[model samples]
Target: MELKKRIKLAYNVLANKSVITKDDQIRSMLDFLGIDQAETKGAVSEATYYACMKVLSESVGKLPLHLQQYTEKGGVRKAREHPLYNVCNSRPNKYMNATNLWGSCEYNRNHYGDGYILIDGAGINTKLWLLPSKNVEVWYDDRKILGDIPDIYYLYSYGGGILKLGSEEVIHVKGFDSLDGITGMSVKERLKNTVNSGIKSQNLINRMYDSGFTAKAVLQYTGDLSDENARKFTKGIEDYATGKLKNDGIKNIIPIPIGATLQPLNIKLTDNQFVELRQYSALQIASAFGIKPYQIGDYTKSSYSSAEAQQLSFYVETLLYIIKQYEEELTYKLLSEKEVAEGYHFKFNISVILRADFATQVKTLSTAVNSFLLTPNEARSKLDLGSVEGGDRLLGNGASIPVGLTGIQYMQNKNPKKGELHNAKK
Candidate 1:
């Protein structure tokens, strides 16, 4: 295609309502012009990126998602009797379990900037289907063709055709970067330079190995040689250097032609600090994902205490955002207005992941039970222990007194007819 025509077509494509997105049109135009864009999915090949994805996906997927209801006392309990409980807590669909579904959703959210879940069916037969973010496009119904009110719609491009779903039919978990709040900006779009640099550094190391780790050098000779002789000499040097022409199990010791001296260029990898640059790039990528270096196995500066603290920091700084978005989307999309108004919502059992050491857990639970913050059975239930007799009631230390009785102890020995001095003596 001609440049002008391609540009016109790109503009038209961007202007079209049926197009995937404006970004998609721009990317397609660049692709047509032989310009390659670094893809977010391609970053998964990088070790740190893969580790970050795994850390987040597993951390969230392994935790139990509960359909909780608020009690009269303002405490929450699992609403196991609700029809959505099984869908949220255990089996989401016939093919995938809750762990796989939630993990895939989280993975897609981080990789593609938005994760989608199709809320299929209604009432007791409802099933959740995880949709690929690549095929799903967020579209606005400015004309209100789908409904009486202007709202957002999801256009899922599948092999058969495009499936238009309403906003209520899909649960969309958006990433950290979103300007319009409808579509999210991917990590690849935001950190393209960093990702490309990391990929280039990896490729450079790989090419060095492939080239037999040879340094750039110039061949010096006293006399000019024929083109044929020069070509033969160059091929010989390359074959020998790359071990393609090995003798006596020796390689990389290229034999110089007669009257020729090879002068190597002194550009050491150390001088460039290639390793340090790559390490820095890794840190930057990890930071972009809100991942700690220790989580990805770069524990150079980590200690026992700091590592434990990083676990909490990881939850607060990284997983907290992901979990909150998931909870909000799931609750809003999966529950009806009545259910939401009645305090029925979806929540992740974060305690499953934020659990402390056994000793710490025991002490913490004991403290909660003794302080009357948790009933004895509640503390036992957290530890997966069955309740004992009289465990349902809250336990507390005997030192606490009612607020109204605060000054009663001081007046215990007071007599209405006695003076202050007589009462003090008594």
Candidate 2:
């Protein structure tokens, strides 16, 4: 009955936006219908799940997100002068840094299945704020109330009331398994069974320890006592097992009542393969998050070489999609139409995260320079080395020729004996 009331309240909040609603009304509405923010947090209390979230959030948080502009030479450079550049690159608002903004956004994305950034103002006075995904509801403007064209809008329940925001006002980072593109399926919802099992497994272990490592058993009594007495007796046993009945250190003896036989179950956690079950659950959850087992400190079958390969694979497979989504969303929502048309957008410097060992990096850069794929100065810039004289030009081995002249050298040689003789005679 209570659940139904809350559901009705939520519908009311969504349907009627004629007047402003208070915080209490919004709170109750979310309490029943919205994402269980508490439950989402509790799920992260599991070690494996928390680790995966941390890995993803921190991976994005550490990289520099810059506003970039296309150069005449068809290359990109940071657009330092743009008004919104500093907001995304460093301080999003007075209270948060870029790291906090990105990390919190990712954490919310994983926890709530959607993360939102509200673009508070326009132009020079712009302020970016992270909105709690639970409090924000997405609605499509099917009625064309806001504009003639139907589009998605946001209803944010905050202190004052439900604030209706246009699509441009919010940046919605969606998760996987979204039936409708506007909303995403949260990790907690998608992997509820596995996560719940893990939590239960942890609780079971805690209970076992609290009972002084005792297994469950049957207390077979010959006769039944009165209801009150039975209740008291059960309470006494539980108190004794949990060490709540404090007598002066009478260690290691649980006295059995007369005519009652305690039949031990002889079941052990080891017998049930509890450890293996936990490991399997961790791996399964991690895999769902696109995390390699080795990343979460499970290097059971890892080699140094394989670890290196997995690191590259992690960037290509996992982080690439995550970064690209962020870049596209940020570019679309933050930049003006004119700026986007002028080829100005946002990009994350992912090279910082994918940096290889010094020796490998040097070798790779050297090969790029040798093949004329990168100018000597360009390769030097990657190493943070100062440019040397004449290093700006593309330099390669003498034997290598341009793609257009691939067979021209051979053709010249074949017709070349006559040409060579003419040159010699001259």
Candidate 3:
């Protein structure tokens, strides 16, 4: 297609055409990161962007990704030799480690409402790279897609020089976009107003500091005064406020003229209004980004238990959904049609976040072993200990049950000592 026809098709195909909105910051962000950079605007504040991205990236990066094959009982995990495993756990690309790959996917998803993980190579040997949604244009016939038998997919990826666009046949691991098409709703876009309010609040505070912390004050005179005299009086007051006193070059104390009285007009406005506005604005921004309010130091009406619950909620409600989306995307995009039919899939092991202390782990493993759910060797292996000679045998309540109906018989046969009696079955 020629540039003119392609441009027309692009507009016809894309839900949001190329055109930056009026807001400068939002327009720049969209042009930089939107699906169609030529014409779009995504609302996001400079104040809360880093905080939102940091929280999301760290939350996702710490999870362990695994490739598993289904079994009759459940699914058995595969690592080391698995081709998908190596790509996800060992190496993703030349520049990024496993954490970087996972975290960057999540970071872009949160910021752009969609993240594209491009998969390269074939079978087990694969490489993954993130494609900014702003630079990616998905081209497919709408009628073909509705029929559920689309023969071709044209994904245009723009990178390299200013006007260069790259085309590829293989599809990338597509992050879940809240919206249906290229134009998706992001957290940053959702909190545009709140973040803008925060920006305005910050500006107000900065203006306060920049004007020697006395920008809200006014000059008034009881008797008639000329405009020139009024200007002079104001200058005198400003000089006194920011003047040298006690040989110090600070603006704290000032000597007033004999009959002049300086009354602060916005004393009430400066006291708690802006502070509360900013505090509320910060909470809204954090909430919009799915971050715990306490994480950003909003302790209003917060208690120890509440904070703990919020932390767990962040993992369970927010991060778990994101992690599951990534797992499904990786499974569908990474595995072949034959592999998917064979029940191969990807999963994230989030147990690291819930990892208990050494004592707790040992106690839990011991209980599992005593209940005959796991052998001693299995528990030891979990603890990274080498196997011992009889560790594989399952031990009942009272030593090994070679030929016993009850644990008491074995206990009586052994005649356990007082300390050993603690292992007796109830």
**Top candidate when judged by TM-score against the true structure:** 1
- lDDT of model number 3: 0.65
**Could you give candidate 1's per-residue lDDT for residues 44-136 as a string of tens digits?**
777777888898889989989999999889999889999999998899999999999999998998889999999999879999999989888
lDDT of 2 by residue, 17-110 (tens): 4443444455656666654554334688888999999999998899899899999899777899998889998999999999999999988898
Give all TM-scores, in the order shown.
Answer: 0.84, 0.80, 0.69
Error of 1 at 42 (Å): 1.3
Weakest lDDT window of 10 consecutive positions for candidate 2: 17-26
What overall lDDT goes with each candidate model? 0.83, 0.82, 0.65
Q: What is the model-wide C-alpha lDDT for candidate 2?
A: 0.82
Off by over 4 Å in 1: 1-41, 145-149, 246-252, 300-306, 407-426
CA RMSD for every model?
5.9, 5.8, 9.1
